[model samples]
Target: MKKPKLELDEPQPRKIIRADKAPTEGYSLVVDGHFKSHHDTVEAAEEAGMALKNRYQMLQIQVYDAVTKTRSMIEWPAPV
Candidate 1:
């Protein structure tokens, strides 16, 4: 039997900081699953995430390190 092909749905709006190698940079900042920019360090990427929060009012942010394969999340200004 043959199987059919599958396609994924559109991505949702979100912020992410993660390590990357394809760009030849140290790390990258992504928004809504789209590459936003690259940074020299993860810390710089985190700063970009904060900037996204302040500028775009994003409620949540996710950080991932490809080197360590670890992930974390940041909540922008705890909901009141």
Candidate 2:
């Protein structure tokens, strides 16, 4: 008897995002739904996330609140 071969596929976004676990004990900065950085406070993480999103409008940036257990997406600003 012959066995069938299996095929594996992976998603490749424009920018390679790190496959890391988000901070479970503090605020975290997530990029493209993947864990990016950890911050002591929510404000710091929010600021960094916003700045990165504002600079690169193509990326999906977000601020994750570990305490509240929620994630907020950083919407791109409108053209002036």
TM-score (C-alpha, index-matched) for candidate 2: 0.65
lDDT tens digits, residues 1-80, model 1? 88987878978978454334324336555555545566678888888787787877754565556566554554576345
Q: Estimate each model's TM-score.
A: 0.49, 0.65
| Candidate models: Cα lDDT each | 0.61, 0.79
Clashes of 1: 0
What lDDT score goes with residue 27 in model 2? Answer: 82
Residue 16 of model 2 has an lDDT of 37
- Model 2 per-residue lDDT tens digits across residues 1-80: 88987867865657333447555667888888788888889889888987898899899988889888899887778334
lDDT of 2: 0.79
